[model samples]
Target: MKQMTLKTTSDLSLAIAKDRFSRGTLWRFPARVPLLLLVTGLCLQMPAVWAQQQETPGKAAIPQESPFGTYGSFEKLLQAAQGGDADAQVKVSLCYGKGIGVTQDYEKAFTWAMKAAEQENAGGASIVAGCYLQGKGVEQNIPQAIEWVTKAANRGDVMAQYNLAATYYEGLYGIPKDEEKAFFWAEKAANQGDREAQCLLGVCYLTGKGVTKNLEKSAYWSQKASDQGAPAAQRNMGIFYAMGLGGLKKDVNKALELWKKAAEAGDSEAQYALGSCYAGDVEYYDPDKIYQNMPEAKKWLQKAADQGHERAKETLERLFHIKASS
Candidate 1:
């Protein structure tokens, strides 16, 4: 039987961030969202309510939702917020924070978010944490940010849980990497149905980080996330089927099916995998003539190599004697 190496933790972190952007989540804390780029991995991007679900690559995701929700106007939203509607208060905060139907005012945003938080809104606590994290309307305080986000996570905010997990995983805020806490928060968000968190949890299980290495559990989470169109999980599932890991029988066709989905989603590694599969007669690389087409191989390999995937470039150079510019 043949086996392929799993992605390193940092590479997987990059994939997780890509997945967040793929979801089309939008938020602004005065400027760019705060994400620590450090040696300890787990990349994270905050998610908010403004953006729509992503539909296709290279296209505007979908129609952005109105910040006012059913109220249809900022005035109506503010009125509702003043009336102590926690959900409306959160929307009002976004209106101020993002300047949607209101002037950009981080102070007002913080105030509105605090009102919602006082009402015990989980999402509102997360918003307040972002304020502290970015120093948007509050003094930058990592401790306060962590405290607020932890509150949100305890209240079952999925994004807050995912963010907390990434923070601990990356040892952000100068804290030591705590794999146990990372796994704890990741499990919370993954179980609450976050695709990125699910992918992270799968990788954690696969690598025995904060848990025993359990291929079956890894496959279970990967399959769930892949079913939700997570490209990273799709690629992982493709490898699982290809190598007969996690109780799966080796099935090249099944592997191609999964890899094609991830490749179309713009995963360079998956594109390389697909191109490699379509190339002719490499030992332990692919099945026989059932999946050979040089044109398809070149097309996918070029795409991967364009993204600077070394293996794709090497394969194109060695097998087809073609130079792929990086």
Candidate 2:
């Protein structure tokens, strides 16, 4: 088996960040939406009476209900929030926070979210933590964010758990680094089927960080997250299959299958692998199985190139020059 090495964009970014933060240990945070849903329900339970109050600058006084019922408008949602509707409050806060269908205003975002969080809304608490953590309409306060995230995590908010695990993993803030604690929380969230946690856990197993180096465990967790449609996990699984590592038998067919799935999902690594497969004369690359004549290699390579997969771009350039000269 030939081992082909490819340069990845993330590798370059990591290298740059490492060089910059060398003297000072910068924690890598992996918080995603999966870790924030722990308080989702609480954020959805606020009273709906406050829905009528409009807090934006120079916005029309919108009606509570759009001309069509169930038409899905932020104005109605805000009205519902003002009416003390918890779910409406969460929706409105998100709208304000993200500037969706309204002007972006973190203060307004915090104001609405705080209303729900004050009521012990789990989702609201998580959102509030996010606001403080990112300084969205509030000061960037890691301690305060951690405080709220901890509250949400203790309540089994999956998103909060993920965020907390990420925090522990990165060891940012005044918090000391603790990989063991990170792994514990990640495992808890992964067991609950959190894709990000599952992916991170897979990486941990792969790198022997916070756990014994176990390729089998790495592939297992990666597969779990991959099945849930995580692009990175899908690409990693394809790599595992290709290398026959992590208890996976060398199955070029399986590798190709996974590579195709992930490539189509916009993963540059998988795209490059798919291009290689289609351009080859392997048994599985028979005309019937692979549309080799359809310029697949170019297509996949171009996709990977667009993603800054250096090797793919070089390959494409070489192929183009060869074709042009001929």
lDDT for each residue of candidate 1 in 140-165, tens digit (9 for 90 to 100): 77778788888888988776787777
RMSD of 1: 6.9
lDDT of 2 at 66: 38
Tell me model 2's lDDT, rounded to 2 decimals.
Answer: 0.61
Question: Each candidate's lDDT (Cα)?
Answer: 0.69, 0.61
Each model's total of backbone clashes: 0, 30
Model 1 TM-score? Answer: 0.80
TM per prediction: 0.80, 0.65
Worst 10 residues of 2 by lDDT: 47-56
How far residue 268's Cα lies from its native spot in candidate 2, in Å, is 1.0
Model 2, span 1-326: residue lDDT tens: 23344332122111111222233422211122222222222222111111111111112223444321252676776787888976567556766765667887778888887787777776677777767766777877878877887776776666566666666766656678678877887898788777767877887777766888787888899898888776667777776765567888866667778888878876677788778666662323435445554288778877878877776776666664422111
